[model samples]
Every structure is written in C-alpha cells, then in structure tokens.
Target: MHTQRISGQAGQTGRRWGALAAAAALVLGAAACSGGSDGKSAGGKVELTYRIWDSTQQPAMQKIVDAFEATHPSVKVKIQLTANQEYWTKLQADATSGSAPDVFWMNGPNAQLYESNGMLLPLSDKLAANGVNLADYPSSLVSLYQHKGKQYGIPKDFDTVGLWYNKKLFDAAGVKYPDDTWTWQTVQEAARKLTDASKKQYGILAPAFGQENYYNTIFQAGGSVISADGTSSGYDQPAATAGLKFWTDLIKDGSSPSLKSMTDTFPSQFFESGKVAMYYGGSWNSSTFAKNSALKDDVDVAVLPQGTKRAVVIHGLANVAYAKTKHPDEAAALVAFLGSKQAAEIGAKESGVIPAFNNTQQAWVDATPGFHLQAFLDELPYAMPYPTSKNTSVWQTQEPITFAPAWEGKSDVGAVAQKMADLMNTALSKEK
Candidate 1:
C-alpha cells in the first residue's frame, strides 16, 4: 500500500482523496478502537488478519505487523499468505460471501467491480483522521481504486514492462548492448541476427494471450483496447491489426519461435534458459530470473521499443478492507499501517519488488546491478493503464481463447480481431 507503477484511470480528485482516505483509516482505528472494545483486557487482543498472494512477502509484511503492534499494544495481526491465481479466486469467494480478511491485496483489473459494488470502504476520511498525506504514494495508481469519487484501497507495489534480453545470446551473436531508442524493426532485426536455428533458439518470444505482456504493444500501435467511453471494445482499429501482425508475422517470417514451441513453454522457462533472444515482460520477473545462474551477468533490461506511441503498462497491487468486516476499526488500522511508507520500505527491501511509495522504490532498483530499472521508472509518466473495467475478470479469463484463433492460424487476423472487439463489447455491455 504505497505505490509503484500504478495502472487504471486516476480520477480527477483521486489523489486528493487518496491522501485523506489512507490517513482516515488510521485515525478512525486508533480513536474508535482504543479503550472502546474488548481489546483492552489482559486475555483479549484485537486480531486483524491480512491476506496476500506472495509467500515471499510474508516476512516483510510480518515486519510491518511487528511495527504496528509495537505502536498499538492491544492489537495483534495475523498474516495469511496465498500464492498467485488462487489468491484472486479465493479472495473473490470470501469477499462475495462477506467473510473476507481484515485487509487483503486488490488488483487494478478488479478494483472497479469491487469499489462499484460497495464491497470496499471509502478510506479518505479515515486517512485524513490519521493525518497522513496521500502525496507520499504514487498518485497515478491511487486513482485506480477510486470509483465514482471514493478511495477504496492503497497501492502496494506497481510494475512496468521492459525488454529483457538473454545476455549470453547477445554476446554469442556479438551484438552490441540494446539502447533506449530501439524499435520493433530493430528488435526484429536483432532477433534475426541472434537466432541460431540449429541450436533451436530464436530472436524473441512469440506474443501470448495475456494483456500483461502484449496489451502495451496493442496500445503503442495507436490502437485501443476499449472504447473512449469505457463502455465497449476498441480493438477493431488498424493499429490493433498491425500490433497483432507485428508478432504473428514474426512467427510467420521465422523471426520468433514457433507458436507451437512457445505454447509448450512460456518466456519464463525459455527466455531465461537463453533459448530466446528477448522478451517483453514486467520487472517482477527479477527474482525468477536471478535463479538462472547460467544467464548470470548475461541478462540486461531495456526500455520497450516504441511503436506509433511510447506507451507502457503500469500495474499495482493494493490493500482493501472488506466493507462488511465486524472489526471495522481494527481492519482499517491494519489497512492504514500497510499503506504507510514504513510498510512500503519493508516490502521493497525484503520482498525485492519495486516499491509503490515514491520515496522507497529506489532501494529496490539498487538491489541488483546491470538491470536497466531506471528505464522502467522513466517510462512511468507516459505509461497507460491496462484496459481494465468493471468485469475485468471476464476479460482476463476469456482472452486466451479469444486470441487463440490467430495464434493457431485457424482464423484470419481481421475476422478474429473484429470478433474479439464485438465479444469484448458484449461483455462490457453485460456489466452495464
């Protein structure tokens, strides 16, 4: 709950309310719960539960909990660590049933639905009461959690995409280091230069179904994913077709790996093995990449090449308290503490993520050497939020199959793309 690279539309009043809401949660908790509930008895302590997907973040969050307890003697915090996909599904079920934890991670894609449905509390007043300023966190991301004009959560950490290359492959090919101004044409040319068909290696990873790695390109092509009004699909443009063509054509041209080969193995396993020249992905892949000692000192980062636009995707995880919590005050307190700069630093240093708080992120960048993390930070201001909406879960779940035909060559690009836009429009319409 601080901010890193944030995604989604920041509202007109989003940042103003964010600063106030985070502080209000803290103030409301300390004032309303102190000596007011059964929390004061020698045998009883206020228990607040937190849930998150990263098991690696547990120790860091524990440090935050320890700090919170040191300040509030009557409160004891419990942490429940859930890993990736399961975390979202389980959290959804619990929240829908009104049995969610005191505080849990919220993602941009689903933030709108949660906030719009009144499942999340507006924290502006509570943050104001605690006397903290939202200006400390990344204001761009704070807007994602606000709906209609109320702040619902605080950013934890955010990420941006970069062109991660296999250093060993580049060296083997005697290619020079990649620079900031590299373009899609340059990347394709380089991939062609570095490719060794005999060794079963290619220039780049094939485009995938997920928006995380591919959406930014779609955007950069001067294409749109959703309508300007945020009410329908915007993928029917020539830019989108060009964006799709950029990758699939690479596969058709034998510049990138075959779709069949990539289908069996994702970039994580393939690219990290030095079997691929470059792949566009998030900064979060560091820890996983660090495990590849074979590629040690051989891998480096660069800004993603621009298309018609210099666009990048910004994403974040946030802390949101269930509106139906029985221990509202205690829950809010937990949320506030999580959103603090202190918690931000703990998470950044211990979990090794790019911190969400503006001040604490540099330490994370410095955690490793030779990675072009600065490029990622520099890309933030021009970054575009992922095209998420009130029913993002639907989009995320449907994308793999929706984009599959083109990937499989079973359907032509224009027809598949047009149908995709229509289907997306239908889904967004269902939300209305």
Candidate 2:
C-alpha cells in the first residue's frame, strides 16, 4: 500500500514509522512484565544481565526487568538488546567465551542449538519447583523447547498468522471485507480482482522465510514441515510440494508482487498505506497496526483463510537461562517471575501480542476495540511449531535459492520444491 505523505518522514516513499512507538504504547505496557510476580527472591544482592533484540520491545523488557528487580531487591536485572540477528550472533560469541547473559530470549530455530550445546540450563526442574505448569502453554511451543524428554525453557506466549487487509482498497474494488470464513480460493479470487499492476498494488507479500512465510500454508495443505522425527525435509513430501505450489502459482500469475519488490519495499509502512491489500503474517503486527493513525480504523485483520485444511502455525518464544551463569538461583527466580500471570499480562498489554499464559491473553484482545484479536487466540489450539534442529538453519540459508523460482515465476513450483528437498538432504548428510 502507498501512503500520501503530508511531509516529514525518511525512506524511499516518505512512509513514517514514527507512529509505531506510540502504537506500542496504546495498549498494555508494564503490566505485561510485572503481573508475573509478587514474590521476593532469595537474598544474594546479585546483578545479572538479560538480553533480547528489538528496541521496540525494550521499554516493555525494561519494565519487566524493573519488576524483577523490585520483587527481588537482592537481584538486580541489567538488560542488553540488539537486532534479532545480532543478538543471536553476540550470544553465540558470549557462549564461546563462557560469558553469556543470565537470561535471554530463545526461539524455535536456535532453541535446540543452545540447549544441545549446553549453552542453556534446562528449566524443567526449576519450573516444577516454582509450581509453573507446562500445561498452561500451547503444546507446540512447550514442545519446541523440549528435546529428548527434557525441557530447557519456559513457553512465553504464542502468535499465529493472519490476513491483514486494506479496507480502503476493498472499498474501491467493491469487494466485501474478508472474515473468518474466507478460504484460500476466495482470497486468490479477490487478489486477481483487486490487483492492478498499473498502480503498483499487488495481492500479497509472500516472503521467502519457509517457516515464517510458507510453513503455515504448507501444513495447511495437509503437510508437515518436517518428518515426525525432525530428521528429514518435508518439502519433497507431496502435501508440502502441493502447498508450495499454491502461493507460487499466485506469483506466477502476477497476483502477488515479485520477491524482489518485497525486499525493496518498506513493509511496515506499506501494509498501512494500502500499497499491499493483504499481508500473510502473524498477530505480532497488532501493536504496529494499532499505532498508524493514517490507517488504524481503515485497516483490520482476519483469520488466515484455510488451505486444503484449516490450521495455523503457533509461533512463540521461550525465556531460557544461560548454563554458565554465576547467578543460577537468581536466574531461576527471574524465570519464575516472568512465567507468572502478571508478567504474561504485561507482555500482552504492553506488547499487544497474545500473552503466552492462559487468561492473560484475553485481557489483551479485550483491550482492542474492533480487532477481536481473539482470532489468533482461537488459532492457538491449531498452531504448529518447529525448533531449528541441528541442520534446519543450514537449509534455511539455502531455502530462498531453492524456492526462488516458485516466487520468481520462472519454474515449476513443485519441481523447485523437490529440488529444495534434495538440497536439504544434501545438507543433512553433511551434519552426520
């Protein structure tokens, strides 16, 4: 979607992201971080470092840190943050030097990598001691941090993919808005009708992240991202290939923007500006969307249309402690405080994302007027998660090259999917 700038804002098209800061403040703020605890920590007067990415979330994280500090006056929390990629790289460097932060955010892809290399201290016992229940979290996320029957982290909260659309564009096209009942077929038809290359408006943005962008679609077509064992590629699996074809066909037919256009566009601004009619992403966008005064009321969300099957991917984070911390007890206390309903609610209210904990998630959705963010809440039951296995990231780096033609509009998507499978297998063999 393109924006009509009245001036002020930097970027290719003068799209302003300044509102994101205010949008983040619109809902819950520190309640998310503090609601987690009222208990005091054991006396140690220990100061430990916590790390995360995304300065956008820093205020919320700092609030969480402050609450942790208040509850445990003896335990002081220091926060360190960086971009997502840089955070991981720096954490890895710290791991090599045996100087990692006490607590850090861990996700599916590298969760196992950290746990397996002994960089993360397992929390199953700590959780049990604190009376924290794994049953409270979505199963996919709980399982994502578990390897070989041992859980190394606590399930923070979960998010699901959705269809965000520009209401203005829908009005212009004389098409009704999408809702929970819309299907992939209906979305495609709308895209074909709504698309106008002359205006640089396309149907959707199909990014290259297999797990982030295509995993939901692939599995929605009745396929799994990986085998039951998490040992082999699921791309060559027939259902998975058919799933890849579904979106690739849209690109092939020009119903969506080319991958190049996607990379070049300032995405956060585009969705609100109406340059793209629908964005297939997750609920995390709720806060960002709520902030845009230019598009807030005019924009909205819907459940992701079903593919051959009805499903959603459950993406979430795990707050894992470092293995080599000098403050293991303090780290454990922080994790427990963080897992409490209060902390979860703080994250929900401040972050505008669903709280990983039960009950608290509703508070966030209830706070949104017309958003009914509950669609993602309902999707939680049907979400799937995949942790980066020892070899997953290796294939991830190569996925765009293998899956390129599908979105590039040059080759048979199914064939490229098969080639993707072969390439992954080649990488997997080297892992042994």
Q: Give lDDT per model, in order.
A: 0.69, 0.68
Query: How close is every model to the real structure, measured as TM-score?
Result: 0.86, 0.85
**Which lDDT tens digits does candidate 1 get at residues 53-133?**
666677887898899889888888778876553565565556544466777888787677667666676788788765456
| Cα lDDT of model 2 by residue, 349-384, tens digit | 675556787778777787676675777777766777
Q: What is the lDDT for 51 in model 1?
A: 79
Best by TM-score: 1
- lDDT comparing candidate 1 with the true structure: 0.69
Those runs of model 1 whose alpha carbons end farther than 4 Å from true positions after fitting are 1-42
**Model 2, which residues run further than 4 Å from truth?**
1-44, 266-268, 366-370
For each candidate in turn, give its C-alpha RMSD to the true structure in angstroms: 7.3, 8.8
Q: Given candidate 2, what's the lDDT at residue 385?
A: 75
